[model samples]
Structures are given as structure tokens and as C-alpha cells.
Target: MQLKIVLAVLGIVGGSAIALAQTMQSNHGDGMDHVTHGQDKPADAFGLTEPGQGAFAALSEVVRFLEADPETAWSRVDLTGLRAHLVDMDRLITDTVVSETELPDGISALATGDIETRATLRRMVPAHAAQLMRDGRWAVEVSVLENGMELRVTSDDPAVVARIKGLGFFGLMASQDHHRKHHLMMARGNDVHAH
Candidate 1:
């Protein structure tokens, strides 16, 4: 039973790696179809397999998906919009200075940066707070200040409160699996932020 569970978990995790590898292979047309040919190729032969940095890897994945789809509307594809969103993410991660305060229920985080970063914070924090609220776990609130953005997260359960404090701002932002689907939609010219 344990082995079966482990295999099931691995299958779920490995599915993405397999899809990525196939996408990379198809994009490159390297004449080596490992899935079909059963070639015992060295893993290193597939380049770094790191797929570059975070934003680049994400854009690459989106592009690969676009390329793989036969019905993809190239005319409707909006990579520029996707790139802008990725830039906002980069600013959020690299530019912001975050100070976290412990709260009885969870934590309060004030994230500050330059003009661009502050704008990013104002735009993203509340959106993420809304996303967190949907899980029915944590109560997240956001305030946009002149120089910074403030996020307050709390929970009813003591353990969840502890988890909220541990996660702080960034981990909370990274919590959901909706990001991948959101990116895909954005790349396909859909306004994911539209209410």
C-alpha cells in the first residue's frame, strides 16, 4: 500500500517533467524522441534542464504550450501582456523590502520599495489576498500605502495561524496552484485579473 501510494505521488509529480521534456524535445526537433525511440540518452544531453531563470522558464513553458497546440490562435496570442505580468513578479520578488510583525492570530507584513515596486505591490497584494480568501482557510487583508503595501493575514485555527505567520508574505503569495493556469490564460490573451 505504501509503495503504491509512493508510486502514485511520483506519477503525479513526474507527469509535468515528462510533459516539459516532450515539449522541449518537440520545440528543438533534435531528432531524438526518447519516448518513441526508447533511446538511453544521457540526461545532460538535454542541456542544463534548468530552463533558465524563473520568468524565462515560465515564458518558455507558455510558448511551448502555444506551439504544441494545433488550434492556437497566433493572432490572438498576447505574449507582451504575459511579459508585463512576469516583470511585475520580478519586481515583487527582487525589489521589495518586507518587514513582518508577529500577530496574535498570524502576521502583518509591510512591503516597501521604489515606485515600480510599490505599484507592483499595490496591484498584486490585494489580488493574492483575494485568492487566499477563496481557500476558506486564512483571512487576508491588504492596504495600499504611499510608500508601501501592508498585508495582514490571520486564521481561526491556532495551527493555521502559526502556519500563516510562518508563511509570511512571500510564501502566502506562492500558496496556490492557480498561477500556472493563470499564466496560460494570460498568454492566450485572456485578462485573468478581470473581475
Candidate 2:
């Protein structure tokens, strides 16, 4: 059982790494030169957009830095460094003008999942997890409950959940609705027994 959990955690980490790699590769050639969108355009498309661009630029800089020399880059990145990166990225996104362009349903779903996963892991894991946001990419500590495995997600956005689920451990962290329903059912069962 333990070995299975370990394998599952490895699978998730490996899958997320691959996804991040693919995303990075796909976005590599563009590098903030242009913005590509599908059929729908965001409502606030032209409102105020410099910050997002700047944030992406900053992210690009970090990616380059890491690519140039990972060993040195990693050493320079401490907890504070990670937090600073996140702040910078958050500032870039929040300050920028957002549009009604539906913001991509997948992006929102992934963000929601990311937030939930972070919260769940934080609550369940004893070790501290670090987060870094740079060059439009983010590195967040993701924990697998099966074997207490720790992995870092490197991505431009919060769309790392798909990769997380691919690892197979995501199902272990029950969704909020699932937990609530289970609790409700248990409570009902207890009520019947008490009567």
C-alpha cells in the first residue's frame, strides 16, 4: 500500500512536471510579444493592461535566469525570494485591467483547484511549503498524502490541477461537496440510530 501511494505521488509529480514543461514550451516562442485568444474576448480587454504585460515580462526574466544556471538560481531563492515573486505576480494581475472575456473557464477551475489543494495540503502536511512566482511562472509546494511526497509545480498560471490530478493522488483529497455530503449522511444515520 505504501509503495502504491509512493508511485501514485510520483506519477502526479511527473505528470505536473510534464504539463508545466509543455505549457512553457508552447508559450516560449511568443514571450509576451502578443496576446492570443480564442473565440471569446474579455469585456475589460482594453481597460488597463500594462501590469499584466509587465508581470509577464518579469516572469520571462526569471525563467531565463533559471535556465541560464539552475544551481545558482536555486541557491538565491529562499523563502523571502519566493514570497516576493508571488507578490510581484499578484500585483501584476490584480492591478491590471481585466475583461469579461470569461477569463477561460479552465483557468478559473484550475485556480479553484489550486487554492483548494494548497489549503488542504497546508492543513494536512507538517512541513512548510514554499511558493515562488517569477517570469509568468510559479513554483508551489504540492504535497501528496499517500507517501508524504513533496513536489514543486512550475507553471505560468494556476492551471496545475490537471497535472495534479494526473498523478492520481488528487482523488485522495476529497472535494468539499463530497466531504459535506458524507458528513450529512453520517449525521442522518446517527439521528436514526438515536431515535
Candidate 3:
């Protein structure tokens, strides 16, 4: 009788442990670890997505270039280059229009800077075809052809968000100057762009 009771207790404990392990594994999504899950996949992933590879790639390249040499990046923006980039972005955004909820206070701060800086941002953010301003830190809704891409930028100050929204890659470069250190750029897929 004593032996049977000990075996039963051991069996129950082992079964509980296995069940807990399975639950944890499922939560992690096959051990891949999902950072976010949304309704619509990102535009870049969508096949018919208009903001095709060229548009996104150009933006990425511009961002990288600016990040590498922020001081002189603006100087490189000529009328022709700007127009070409804008055209590509326009193509992408026409289909991927994203709506934003509320603009964050920090993003509003960009308006406080000098006339030139403020003016630059005003012209640039819209020119880059950003759809709307949202409540998250460094947050903005971007439209593409097939779907929209929600870009969430997190930073402590409005200056940083303004710089990035206005300058794109160059703004990210400027962020390095700030005291709050982490610079995270997240591009989500699915309904992640919606809300």
C-alpha cells in the first residue's frame, strides 16, 4: 500500500510538470518568441503592396546614409533627389494609408525649435508621405499600397522624434546626440499598423 501511494504522487507531479512545459512552449509560439501580433501583415511582406521594395529600400538606404554622416546628410538632398524619393514613397503610401490616434507630447515639441528646423519637419514628414501622428513615442502611421506600416519610434524628447520624422535617416543620426540612450525602430506586421 505504501509503495502504491508513493508511485501515484510521483506520477501526478511528473504530469503537472509536463503540462506546464507545454503551456510555456505554446505561449512562446513554437519557441520563436513573438514580439507582437497584429491583424494585417506589414506592407513590405504583402505581395501586391505598392510601397514596393524600391520605395522601402530607398528609405532604408537614406536612413543608413544619414546615420553614417548626419552633419552633411541634408546637404545631399537636392530637388531632383527629393522628388524622386517622394514619388516612390507616394506610390507606396497611396495604398498603405494608416490612421493615427493622438500625437504624443514629445512629438509636439519639435514645433518649438527654430523656424528652419520646424519648417523643415513640416515639409518633410508629409513629403515622406507619413499618414498621421499617433499617441505612442516616436509614433507615426505610414501608408503603403497593399497595407499600412505603423512606425513606432521611442525617445524621451520631441526633438528626437521631430528630427527622425523630418529627416528620416538623418534624424535617427541626430538621436545619438541625446542623453537617453536606447534607439529602437520597430516595424510591425498585420493590424499592428491600425491601433
Which candidate has the top score in TM-score?
A: 1
In candidate 2, clashing pairs total 9
Q: Please report the TM-score between candidate 3 and the true structure.
A: 0.22
Candidate 2 regions with alpha-carbon error over 4 angstroms: 1-52, 70-195
Write down the lDDT of every candidate, Cα atoms only. 0.85, 0.37, 0.40
Local accuracy of candidate 2 as per-residue lDDT tens digits, 1-195: 999999999999999999898777776555443556422556345464333554454444444445566354344343333334344334323432211111221111121124433443333322222212222343344445342234343444446545433332222222223332322322223221111
Please provide TM-scores, in order, for all candidate models, with all chains considered together. Answer: 0.74, 0.17, 0.22
What are the RMSD figures for all models against the true structure?
Answer: 15.1, 27.0, 18.9
Residue-level lDDT of model 3, residues 11-124, one tens digit each, is: 999999998988877676542546654236763453542334654554554455456664643544433443343453343334222233324532222221234333333433
Cα lDDT tens digits, model 1, 1-195, are 999999999998899888888787575455554465436656346465457888898999899889989989898899888888889888898899999999898999999999888888887888878888897778888888879999999988999998998787899988876888988998998878842
List candidate 3 segments past 4 Å from native.
Answer: 1-21, 36-53, 70-195
Once model 3 is optimally superposed onto the true structure by TM-score, how far is the C-alpha of residue 186 displaced, in angstroms?
26
Q: Note the clash tally of each candidate.
A: 0, 9, 13
